[model samples]
Target: MNESKEFLKEYDDSKYKKPSATVDMIILTAVDVETKARSVPDKVLRVLLIKRKGDPLVVDITDPYKGKWALPGGFVNYYEDLDAAAIRELREETNISDVYMEQLYTWGKVYRDLRRRVISTSYMALVDSSKLNIKAGDDAEDACWFDVKITLLEEVKTQIKAGYIRKTTYELSLVNSENEIKDTVIVTKKLEGRTSKIDLEYVNNPSGLAFDHATIIFYALERLKNKVEYTDIAFSLMPEMFTLTELKKLYEVITGKVIYSRNFRDKMEKQKKMVIETDEWESGKPYKPARLFRFNPDWVEDQ
Candidate 1:
């Protein structure tokens, strides 16, 4: 025992290399926009992105990917907790804080970062943009909310030596508040039947998003789609009070599908604890006012 204690006292952690840790944020919101084709307001999904300032070094090499758009992130402090690091990095880069956030995933692909060995733990948040003031700070050159639209371009299935592989391609379009196309990213994801796992890679990303952030955004969206069905997380992006139609539209937008009104209402009715009818209604509209409803805190407690 004394010999082992002596060996431990002389041990050095530097003998084994360690990967650097980082935290990235996916801040999402659903905003109401006026459209020429519709009398009522249309809800659009938006994501916050930051432009990199100064020169970026890629694996000890200065690369052309510098000064491109990327998610708000930074290296984690040595003494900080993972969740605290995520929230602190988000606030430092975007000037937005105190929103609903949860851990999304950890990305540790060997080549994900050209700079050193970096392992990133990402967090996802849903916020009402109107309530918070946002600005670019720290290493961020500029920050803006871009309207996000994802379209499935194609899906292919191929037989490999071991098993079957499914490949799907998606086009991600980022539009500015002025409704102009700011950037477009094409990503392809592959699912292996043998492992039942999916991996994503960039096909043609003109947006020049740093690292594997484009894939991270897509993964976060997929998780949100699944969570909205079984959880009250969707309410985080909604206004304090909204009509049933508004809520339904929000769900459809996130899921990228149109749901029948009757069926959706039926599901909502069955989950009576999820929402409560309020006496307030939308005002200053051409048609009859629609009743407003708020999310029930009781349901959250039950969950």
Candidate 2:
């Protein structure tokens, strides 16, 4: 140990340039957006975003994306762990903590950040927005949950020797009705095989999100959609006790599909055993109250 310490003392520290590291959080939730008509409300997927503050020092001819909306994040401290940085950034930006979060991907494209070479590690977080009190943190001008809608615009598949290569293009839209803010991002995904190399790119970014956040958001959404099919990760976006209808709506929002009630319940309860019956039922509805259920903690995906 003493010999190692002596070697470290003589080692050069600045032999190679190190890229700045940042942690971006893709915090998602489900909420009932207000509508014009008085009727049963359906929940939609929303993502928490921070409005970047215009810094006079940083804003110049080279940096024109100062005031645009971006994923909630900040530079990681040199001593902080990646996961710890993600949790800290989430808590600092949205006043949120203790939610389901997992590392998604690492983006290190050169020129992704114009100011400097920055490598960002992204984390996906799921929360039940109804239960949390959210507010913008200090580093941001404002924070809001924008309703998320992703539409597949085009797709192509080609046969290859090893496997098929599929390329899909999507339009990602985020709208905050109350704030009158809307951002649109176009991204394309390429998969070489069933489990081979995967690539993501931003085809068009009109609103100009900070860094390569639009691509990161697109990747996280894809991961969420795929995970919900086989995992109980959706429960992180649900309340402790919820109706099957509510759960169905959340699933529909995430997967962007219409799921039949009977099949959804049968698959979730009987087939997958992902939920357990609760002693409560939804109240004060015009129709018959539906039975409430809670997530089954011990449920594992069938291999």
- lDDT (Cα atoms) of all candidates against the true structure: 0.80, 0.81
Clashes of each: 1, 0
Least accurate stretch of 10 residues (summed lDDT) in model 1?
179-188
- lDDT of candidate model 1 versus the reference: 0.80
lDDT tens string, model 2, 1-303? Answer: 999999999999798888999999998988875554544468888889988778634657666567778999989998999989888888888788888678889899898887888899898888777777888886778888888878777888877776777777777777886643333444333444466666677754545566778788888888999999999888888888988888998898888899999999998889998999988888887666889999998898882
On residues 1-303, what C-alpha lDDT tens digit does candidate 1 reach at each position?
999999999999998999999999999999887764435566889999988886554433654457778899989999999888888888888998887688899999887887678899999989888888889998888888988887887878877766676777776777785433333334433445546666677654444577878788888888999988888888888888888788888999899999887787766655446778888989987656789988887775344
Where is the poorest 10-residue window by lDDT in model 2?
180-189
RMSD of each: 3.3, 3.2
Task: Give the number of colliding residue pairs in candidate 2.
Answer: 0
* Per-model TM-score on C-alpha atoms: 0.88, 0.86
The RMSD (Cα, Å) of candidate 1 is: 3.3
